[model samples]
Each structure stands twice: as structure tokens, then as C-alpha cells.
Target: METFLKLFENPSVLKFTKLGLWILLIVLIIGFLRKLLKKRIEDTSVRYKAQKGVEIIGYFLIILMIFMAITLDDIKDYTIIIGLFTAGITFTLQELILSIAGSFYIFFVRVYKPGDRIEINNIKGDVIDIDSIYTTLMEMGEWVSSDNYSGRIVKISNAFVFKGPIKNYSMDFPFVWDELNILVTYDSDITLAKDLILAEANELLSEYSQKSKTKWQEMVERYYIENATIEPTIAVNLTDNWIALNLRYITDYKLRRDTRNKLFSNIEKTIRSTKGKVTLASTTLQLLKIPELEVQLKNKL
Candidate 1:
């Protein structure tokens, strides 16, 4: 008991003890406020922002307490030394610092938001969450077709925004131009096939064109972009074995797969209803002639 009392009597020990108590009290108060804020905030995004701010402030306070404890006198004399130390630490953690900066950029500049589909450095996905150091993605189109999710969640460094291109599918213009190619045999009625495809695409995608036109107009007004035709179009290409009719149309980014499926089903039904008028093309190999063996019999008579 005497030794414990003597230790407290020392000025250095007493100062440290007071500093420790203050740190503990600050941490408890900050934690309590964070919990209260989380409960009061209804929106998850707002809650997340509030909690992050509290965490950053808490860290700063703890760091300040440590500095105060270490250097109680002549803080001005140590300014240069602290600045050099900070520079070294910043250099070591440059990537981390950049990621934090990226998070702020994402928040303020609106590079992307949760639920927006984006592709960065060939990694495409829907944004799941934007964190301080990482951006979470529900991955798409690795082994799957037509922007469908591949059942994988990927976390990429937020600093990737500074590294490569960022392609957003559903930003200002939420519609994408997709194509479906139908090949018909040479003997089939090419004109009739083209008419049927164009008719089907127009009927199925008429509503999409209307919706895209409004969104596209908004995009034009917001950015320096030209107005484009959002209607369905048909282009014909003559291949070696068949005539390919390409049906191009605008569709919502999320509904690409479903729209394609419906369009294909309708086109199939329409073509099949034509009986033998529109014959689907298939690859065929024809053997013109087997190599003729010229056997000149040498008669040694």
C-alpha cells in the first residue's frame, strides 16, 4: 500500500495516470454517442457516415492524448520532427491514403452509388457497398452471359478509380444497345425473314424505346452528348453460308437477359409459324470428290 501510494505521489506517474483515465472516459463517451446516433438515424447510409465520422474523431483524440502525454513542454520545438515523421508515414501508407481519398471522391463526385452497375479494370459488377478502403461488388459476366451475376462478391481497392477506366452502365443513360443475330439459309426468303425479325423486335421493344427516349433527353441536357435514335433497328449481313439479320434494340441494363429471352422466344414462334419460308441455317460440309487414284499399270511383258 505504501509503495502504491508513493508511485502516485511521483509527478510523472500521476500525470500518466490522469491521461489514461481521460482517454478511457473519452472512448466510453464516444461509443455511447455512436450507438445513440445509429439508433436515431433511419437511413443506413446516413448511419454509416455518422459512425465513420465518430470513429475518425475518436482516433484523432486518442492520438492527441498520446502526443500530449509524451511531450508536455516545448511542442513548438518538435514541430519539424513531427512533420518529417508524418511525411515518412504518409509515404509508407500512400495506397491507403489514396483509397481514403477515393472514398471521399466517390461520396462527393458520385462516381458510383450502391446498386449501380460498373466495370473497372475488366472487373464488372453491381456496386454493393462503398467503404473507406474498398468497394464491394456483386460480380457479373465472368462465366455468365448478358450481365448476369456470377454468384460471386468481389472487394476491390477504392484506389482503382485512379488506376484504370470506370464504366458505368446505369448512370445517366440506363439503357444499353443490344443485338441479336438470326441466320437464315440461302434458299430461305431473306426479305421475309428480315421483315419478320424487324416486326418482332419493334413489337417487343416499343415500350423500351419510349422509356429510353425520356432518359436519353435528360442525359443530353446534363452532359455534352448528341441525341441518338433509341428505336429498334435491323441490319443485314451476308455471311458465307447464310444471311445474318441483326436485330438491335435499347434495353434497361438490369433487364437485358429477360428482354433477350422474350425477344428470342417471340422471334422463334414467328419464324416457325412461317413453315418452310424461313429456314434456319446450319453448317454443312460437302465432299466434292475423293482423290482419284490413277493406276497406270506398268506391264513388263
Candidate 2:
């Protein structure tokens, strides 16, 4: 390594060292700000936001320092070479670049921040951490299905932010409007069927809706947002052989399955009370013509 030794003997190495010192100073400043911010802030969210700002600034400083180090003396002459080298890397390390860019996009757009439950591409879970190239999720869809965390860890590339359908569960409008469609035979009393579905949804979802509404209203006031009319409603549609009873309501994204369980149990119990009167629609085949023909032939004989 005579070449390596010779490189350090030059003045450019000293310049690189100076830039490193500058970066180290920036780190100390960021650390000081964090300590200062911690003393006055009680909100975890605010502390996290402050920490994130520090981290982003540190990244920029480090990158800039490295770039400055590359621009000294003999190294300064190789700027074009570095450009070409970076271009080559862009083509070869496409996924890495896309992932990095994706992270930036997610951060700036505030698509789904940390602690938000999300379904990205098909994996559903709460976002636990956001790194430069990947987002870590507390894995879901195992024991408790339907977008709830199942106590596992998953790391997905940030590139998925651009390529896949992203579902955010902790947004301003975090509650989701969900429904359970129950169809009954035509012989069922239409009014009774409708009442059953509506009563089940209301009994189970009423408390949650009220609590969510109050919380959302407080958030709206704090954030100075426009008030929205938030109410849960059920609907009914009909066909010849069946009546479609849809129990629609807003629910916590992670608890859609739980809500469904309550709604289904109530609906099942009510429908059971009307046994034989209200039953699920099923396929039926009738041979009326053959029976009538057989009776006529016997009569004629």
C-alpha cells in the first residue's frame, strides 16, 4: 500500500479531516438541540418529530462533508470520474436508489408515518420503524386476521411506496366504513330482516362511534380542520330470492374483524328467533311440469 500511504501524505487528507471535524460539530449541535427539546416537551409525538428533524439534518451534513472531502487536491481532479462512477451505480443499484428515494417521498409526503397501521402491497401491519431503504412492520394477518398485527416482524422495501397500493389506518380520518352483508330468503319478513341488521350494527358499533367521534372532534379543533359529519348507517337491498342486509359502520382499522364478529353474532341470534321465517338464500330446483304431467296421465288412464 505505497499508493495509499502517498495519498495521505498530501495536503488533501488534511482538508478531509477538517470536513470530518465540521460534521462532528454538527452532530454535537444536534445532540444539544435534542436535549433542549426533551426538557420542555411531554408529548411523545412532538419528541419524535424533533428527533426526526435532527436525524435528517445529520444525514445532509454527513453527505455534504463526504462530498467536500472528495473535492480536495488530487481528489478534486477526479470529480468527473466520480460522476461517472455514481452514474454506473445508479444503473447497477437501481433498487437501492429507488428505495432511498421512496423513503424520502414517504417522509416528505407524510403518506403514513411511524406508528400508523398500514397495508402495503398485501402485507398489513403497524409501521414500527422507517429506515433509508426499508420500512419495518409489526407483522399482521396471522392469528387475528383482517389488518391486525399478529406479533411478528417484517421488513419491506420502501420502494413499495411507489409501486403498490398503500393503505393508511392512522390518518386524520382513521376510522373505516365497513359492512357485513347478510342475505335472507324471499319468504323472510322484509321489515324484520332490515331491523335485525340495523339493530345489531347499532348495538355493537354505537359506543365505538361515539368515542371515535369525540376524539376526532378534539383532534379537528386542535389542528384547525373542517368538521365532518360522522355517523354510522346501515342499508338494505332486495332480490326475488333474497334480501341483502348490509350492516355498515365505522370501526378501528385494526378491529374490523372484532366488529364483524359482534355484528355476525347479533344478526345470527336475531335471525334464529325467526327460524323457518328467515333463512339464508339457497339454490332450488323445481320440476312442476313433470309432476303435473304425471297426474294428468294417471287421470286419463
Candidate 3:
């Protein structure tokens, strides 16, 4: 008890204790503010962003307080030491520094926000969080097909923004052009198949097609973009086996698989109604030669 009392009596110890108290107070205040923010903000993305901003500010304040407490007497005398230390830290944490810079770049350049589906480094997912070091994604399309979630969370380094391309699915326009293909026999009525595909796509995706057209027009006006076919259109590719009728149309990214199922089902019904006019194609196996096999007698006999 005497030793503890003496330690507290020392001026340097007292100063450090005061600084520690101040740091604790700051931490508590920031925590309270974050709790208040959580209650006030409803949007997950916005709430997270605000919380991060508050945390950064709190860290800066804590660091500033520490710096001021240590350098109260002679900050100029420590300048060279500080410079050298900063340089060493910069060299040691080069990747970390780059990631921080990339975080700033992502925020300022409006690269993709939380809730946006993005693909970077060939990794496709929906952005869930953006922190100082990493961008967290709810992964999709690994073992799954057509933008379906794969039940995996992926954390990518923010520094990757400098190294690769990022494809955002819902930044300016919230629609994507998707293609569905059906193979029809070479002898089938190619024109009727095309017409049937176009008819089904137009009927099913008419709302999305019209909305995407307006969005594309807005994009054209805002950016230097060319006019595109936003409506449901059909293109035919002649293959060795069959003619591929490709139905291209705009759709909400989230509703792609559902839309495709509806379109395919509807088109199959429509084609079936056409009887033998537009027959679906399949691979035909033509045997050039047959191998002979001999039967063996049973051992039990």
C-alpha cells in the first residue's frame, strides 16, 4: 500500500494517470455516440459508414491526445525521431498503408458501396462491409450459378482496387443484360423459334425492359455511352449441331434466376404449342463402329 501510494505521488506517474483517464473518457464518449447512432440510423450501410467515421475520429483524437501529452515540453526536438520512426513504419507496413489508401479511394471515387453486387479479382459477391483493411463480401457464383449466394463470406484486401478491375452491378443503373439460350434443330423453323423467344422475353420482362431502357437513356445522357438495345431481342447462332436462339433482355440482378425460370417455362410451353414446327434440339450419337464382347461362364456352375 505504501509503494502504491508513492507511485501515485510521483509527478510523471500522475501525468500518465491523468492522460489514461482522458483516453478512457474519450473511448466511453465514442462508444455512447456509436450506440446513439445505431438507434438513430435505420439503413445498415449508412449506419456502418457513420460508425466507421466515428471510430476513425475517435482514434485520431486519442492519438492526438497521446502526442500532445508526450510532446508538451519539446515537440520540435522529437521531430527528426518522429520522422525516422514514421518512415520505418511506412516501410514495414507498406501493404497496410496501401490498403488504407485504397479504402479512401473507394469512398471518394464512389466505387461500390455496401449492398452493391461487385466482382473484383474474378471474385463475385455482394459488398457487405468496407473497413480500413478489407472489403467484406457475401460470396456468390462459386459453385452456384446465376448470381446465387454460395453461403460464404469473402474478405478481400482493399489494396486490390489498385491492382484490378471492379464490376459493379447496381451503381448507376440497377439492371443487367442477361442472355438465355435454347437449341433448336437445324430443320426446325428458325424464324419461328426466334419470334417465339422474342415474344416470351418481351411479355415476361416487359416491365424491366422498359425501366432499363429509361435507365440506359439516363446513362447515355450522363456519360459518353452509346445507345443499346434494352428491349428483349433475339439473336441466332448457327452451330454444327443446332441453331442457338439467344434471348437477350434486361432484368433486375437479384431476380435473374427467377426471371430466367419464368421465361424458359413460358417459352417451352409456347414452343410445345407449335407442335413439330420448332422442335428442341439434342445431341445425337452416331456409332461409326461397335465393339464385340464375350460372355463368361458362372463360377458357381
Candidate 4:
């Protein structure tokens, strides 16, 4: 232990030892603070911000300690050299710098945060985490349909925000307008079909209709947009084979698939209970013209 102490007594060795000790102290302090943060902060978003702020402060302190360990004369002599080295590093790591800048832009602009369902550059997901370089996502809507998670975690570079438009599903308005079409034979009761479909929609989507109006009013006030109907509506169109009743309604962004399933099931049951008054339409081919067929058989000898 005496030999080790003697080795650290050298001026250069002593300076580095102090720097290392300070860095270790910072790490321990940061760890303790993080534990306290976890215990004290219950709100997830607030906790995340505080934890990240502490981490950045810890890094800054470590860098400050390293700079202080260097002699003043060395800094004076190598100032220009350090400037040139930094310039080179900046050029080499320009993409990383842009990514950090993009992260700052995201935070400042409130582009999207953790828990926002967003789509950008053809990738769609619910954001799980956002860091300086990347936005982590619980990926959705690739092979799976209707906003279902694909069981993949995607890490997209934050710099991609600068590249394209982003669609946010759960931001100001957490509800979306979805349309479901029901086709009935031309001879079926179009009025009853529309009434049944509209009734089912009203039943399934009443909550969204009531809640989304206030949220949409906020959006209209914030953006340049006109008032949109939130209540369930039915529009009928006549086609060659069938009469189509398009049922449009508002629903929570995440509940679209389940809501649709329930609405369709209810509508089908209602329509079937009508007992052929509302017959669902299917494409049928009619044999308008048939080619002449000739058959010749030889008599058995």
C-alpha cells in the first residue's frame, strides 16, 4: 500500500487520481439521487424529465472535473489544437449532432411524447421512450391491422423528424372518425337497414360522440379547421347490385378494432332478425348468354 501511495504522489498521478475520485463520487451521487427520484416522483413524465436532468448534470460535472485536472499551461498551448480537433469531430459526427438537435426540437415543439401514437416516414407506433438520439416505439400496423402492436420495438433516429410529416393520433383529439359500410340487396328495405345500422352506431359510439366534441372544439380553436360532426351518421348510396349504407361514427383511437367488431356483430344480428326484410347483398353472376354445345356419340357395334 505504501508503494501504491508513493506512485499516486507524483503530481500528474495525483491530478488524475483526484479526477477519478471525483468522477466516482459523481456517479455515486447520481445513483443516490435517482433512487430518491424513483421513490419521490410518482408521475411518469415528471420522473423521466428529472432523471434525465440529473444524468446530464452528472455528465457535465465529470467533464468539468476532467478539464480542471489538466494544467493551465497545457490548455494554453493546445487551445488551437483542441479547436481544430473539435471542428474535425463535429464534421465527422454531423448526423449525431443533427439527431440531438432534432431531439431538442421535439421537446420544444411538443411534436410527440412518450405514449403518443404517431406515424412518420411510413413507420407507425406508440412512442415508449425518447432519448437524445432515437425515439423508441412499440411498433404497430405492419402485418397486423387496426393499430395492433406487432410485438416489435423500433428505435428510429430522432433526425427523421426533420425529414417528413408526422401524424399524431392521440394528441389534442384522441378520437377518430371511422366508416363502416353495409350492403343490402336492392329489393331489401333500405330504410330499415339505415335505421338499424345508425341505431347500432349510436349505441356503440355514444360516449365518443359526447366526449370528442369538446376535444374537437379545442382543436378547431387551435387550428384552422371547420366544425365536424361527432355523432353517428348514415349515408346511403345506390350501386348496381346493392344499396350501401355507410355508417360513420367517432371512436377512441385505441378502441377502433374492438368497437368495429362489436358494431358489426350487433348490426348483423339486428339485420338477420328482420327475417329477409334486409337481405345482405352478394355479387352474383347471371348466365345471360351461353355458347351452343354439340355432343356426338358413336353407337356401340
Candidate 5:
């Protein structure tokens, strides 16, 4: 009993006990706040931000406790030394530090959020998660057409946002402009082919175009942007062996493949129904005249 009482009376023992209690209290408070915020906030993004804020506060509190315990009475004398040491360590881990900074930038600036389809450094994918140092993506567009997923998950360092362009496909504008070209033999009816393609594109993408216009108007109001045509358009160009009918339209970023498939199916049906009037073009090799040098080579032999 005496020994135990003496142990409690020791200044170091009492300081450590106090520090532990403070840490426990801080943790409990942070946990309680986190639970309360989660219950109150229904939005996933807002909830994520609240949780992150609570975590940062908890970290600061823990660090303060450690600092207080270490400094005790000589805080002024140790401050400069600790600051210099921290600076040196930060310099050594600059990339990691930058990644963390990028994460904060992404969160505050809304560069890209979860469920946003984005491309960074030529890697296109749908963002699945974002942490302090990395952004997780369900990868798309490698060995897959029309931005479809490649069935791979990629973890990219958040620092890449500072290194290269970040293309957010579904940010403020959830639509992207895409075009498809149909080739027909020059002998086919050029005007008829153009008309058919335009009709098909308008039929398939009309609703998408209308929705895109509404969203685009919202974007224009929010940001500095020029008004663009949101309706399907057609362009015709004559190639050496074929006439190219290009159909351009807007579509939801995530539904590019499905949209393309529907457009192609409709166009195919229209062309097939047209019979010979819209015959697809194909390359052919013809013998202009058998090589005249054949007989001369045989005589030399």
C-alpha cells in the first residue's frame, strides 16, 4: 500500500496518467462527434468530410498531448529544434507530403469526387475512393472500347493532380460529345446516305441531347463557357474511295458504349433497309495490266 501510494505521488507517474486520461477523453469525444455527424448528415460526401475533419482534430489533440508531455517546462528551448527537425523530415518525404496536400486540395476545391469519371496521366477510370495519399479508380478504356471498364482497380497517387491534367468527365458537365463516321461507296446516293445517318442519330440521341443542353445551360451559368449546339449534327466528306458521313452528338459520359451501340444498330438497320442506295464501301485490288517485265525476265534467264 505504501509503495503504491508513493508511485502515485511521483510527478512523472502522475503526468503520464493524466496524459493517458486526456487521450482517452479526446478519443471518446471524437468518436461521439463522428457518430453524431454520421447520423445527422445523409449525404455521403458531406459525411466523409465531417469524418475527416474529426480525424484531423483528433490527430492534433494527440500531438498536443505528446508535445505537452515532452516539453513540460522547456517548451521555448525545444520549439526551434523540433521545428527544424520536422522541416527536414518533411523535405525527405516531399512526394508523400504533396500527395496529402493534393488530397486536401481535391476535397476543398472539388476537383473530382467519388463516382466522377476522370482521366489523369492518360489513365481513364471511375473514381471509387479518395484517401489522404491516393485515389482509387475502377479502370476503364484499356483494351476496351468506348470508355468501358477493363475490370481492373487502380490506385493512383494524388500528387498526379499537380503533375498533369485531370480530365473529369462527369464533373459539372456529365455529358461528352462523341462522333461516329459511316463510309459508303461513292456510287451510292451521297445525299441519301447523309440524310439517313442524320435521321438515325437524331432518333437515337435526341433525348440525350435535350438533357445535355439543360445541364450545359447550368454549367454556363456557373462557369465561363460558350454556348454550344447540343443537337445532333451531320457532316459529309468525300474520301478517295468512299463518302464519310460523320454524326456528332452528346451523351452521358458513363453510357458512351451503350449509346454508340444503339446509334450503330439504328444506322445499320437504316442502311440495310436502303438496299443498294447506301452500300458500304470496301477496298479492292484490281490488276491494271499484268506486269510487262515478265517476258523480259524470262529471256534474261
Candidate 6:
């Protein structure tokens, strides 16, 4: 029993003992903070500012602990030993280091912060929080129709920002251009139909186009972005079944579902009011009598 106690008293062992104790203390403190963290963050929307506080505090604690361990004369040699370990850590855990770098990029670059909806790769969601190892997302737009949530939580490595295209839906010039295709009968009066559809789209899209244009111009002045033409219009494609009118126009990104519904409803109404100038296209069935039908009639006679 005395030998075991003496072994633990060794300086090298003591350094490890202190590190474990400090890490354990950090875990407990973090656990307690986690309980109150959600409620506190909900009251304020400055997630970036709040997370900056967390990052600073967490790193401070880690550094202090490391400093204390290094102060031990018995363990000063181990500090040199740790340098050798760093190269191995850098190689083996390179992905994790990149994730940490990504976290810093997210903070300093002011990219998509918590609560903003973003798409990294094909996964789309509202970002719930940014943790040390992974970013949390309220997973959406998979298995569910439209852009609705699947009621699942996803944690993606932050390094994905560099690996794939980062789509920030709520960033500067947050509106998106959604297209709906409507087909009217080919024989329909193309001019009148175009006018009615154009009228509906202009009324529906003009407001958002103006808003997006103003916002985009502000961004252009702040950054070197190419000038954009802020107009909402429809393009027509003539096809066998109908004249395909693609309503390509700007709309609030999050309100895509609602915008689509309004566009479709008004289109239906416009078609009705057009005095038979337009009709929704559909295939008609035509049947001809078979050779057997005439022979059967003659036989009956």
C-alpha cells in the first residue's frame, strides 16, 4: 500500500493527476453552465457576442490549468515532452484542428452565426448553436416535402464550410428567386394569356424586388459586388402540350412556401377571368373503332 502511494507521489504522475483533476473540474462547471445557458441565450439574440464570451472563458480556463501544471519543477521536463506530442496531435487530429480554425473563422469573419438558416453541402437547417467540436442544426428539408423540418438534430463538422459551398439564406440580399411553370393550351391566345400572367406576377413580385434591390445596393457599396438588375418578369417556353410560362422572380427566402401558394392561387384566378383566352393544358383521349368491331356488326346482320 505504501509503494502504491509512493508511486502516485512521483512528479510525472502528479502532473497527470493535476490535469485530470482540472479537466474534471471544467466538465462539472460546464455542465452547470449548460443548464442555464439556453434560457439566458433565448432572452438575447446576439448569439455571436454570447459565443465569443464562451470561447474566451473556456480557453482561459484551459490555459490557466496548463500554466499551473508547467510551474511544477518536477513536471517542467514534461512540457518539452508535450511539444513532441503536438506534432503527432497536429497530424492525427488535423481535421479537428481545422474544425477549430473554422470555428474561429465563423467568429471573426462573422459568417452565418447561430439561429441563422444555412446550407452546408446538401443539409439545410437553422443553426441552433456552435459547440467546440461540431455545429448543431435543426435538420430541415429532407424526407419532408418542401423546406420543412424533419424534426431531427444534426451535428456537422465545421470544416464542411471549406469542403462545400456555404449558402447563407438570411445574409445580405436574403431573397431567393423561385420559379413556377404553368402550361396553357397551345391554341390559347398567347398574347392575352401572357398579359394576364404578367399582371399576376408583377403584382405579386414587385414589392419584394424593390426591397431586395435596395438591400443589394447597400451591400454593393459596402463590398465589390457586380451591379444587379432588380426586375421581376416571366419567360415563356413553347412546348408541345402548352406554352410553358416560367415565373422567375424574387421572394423572401424563408417565405418560399407562402409565395408559391399565392402565385399559384392568383394564377388559377387569372386563368378563370381571362374570358377563355387561356386554359390550363391537359391531354385529351381520342379512340377509334377496332377492325373487329365492323366485322362483328356485319356478322350480326
lDDT of every model, 2 decimals: 0.86, 0.79, 0.88, 0.87, 0.86, 0.80
Per-residue lDDT of model 2, residues 44-110, tens digit only: 8888788768777777778777766775446567678878988998899999989878888889998
Estimate TM-scores for all models. 0.77, 0.69, 0.80, 0.78, 0.77, 0.81
Q: Tell me the tens digit of each residue's lDDT in model 6 across 1-301.
A: 9998998988678777879888788767765665557567765555446655666577568767877776755555566777778788889999998887788778678788887889987899989888666889998887898778899999999888778788898887788878888888887887887778777878888888889989988988999889876666678898776789887778888889898999889988989887787888877778987775444435554
Off by over 4 Å in 2: 1-4, 12-54, 67-76, 92-94, 142-145, 148-151, 210-241, 274-301
Q: 181-243 in candidate 3: lDDT tens per residue?
A: 898998899888888888888888889977888888899999997899888888889889999
Q: Supply the TM-score for candidate 4.
A: 0.78
Task: State the displacement of the C-alpha of residue 148, model 2, in Å, after optimal TM-score superposition.
Answer: 4.3
lDDT preference between candidates 1 and 6, better one: 1
**Cα-based lDDT at residue 60, candidate 4:** 67
Q: What's each prediction's clash count? A: 0, 0, 0, 0, 0, 0
Worst 10 residues of 5 by lDDT: 292-301
RMSD of each: 4.9, 7.0, 5.5, 4.8, 5.3, 4.1
Give the runs in model 3 whose Cα sits over 4 Å from its true position. 1-28, 39-46, 59-76, 287-301
Q: What value does the lDDT take at residue 297 in candidate 2? A: 41
Residue lDDT tens for model 4, 108-173: 798998899999878999999888789999999889877799999999998999999999999999
Clashing pairs in 3: none
**TM-score (C-alpha) between model 2 and the true structure:** 0.69
lDDT measured at residue 71 in model 4 versus the true structure, 0 to 100: 44
- For residue 151, model 1's alpha carbon misses the true position, in angstroms, by 2.2
Q: By the TM-score metric, which is better: model 4 or model 5?
A: 4
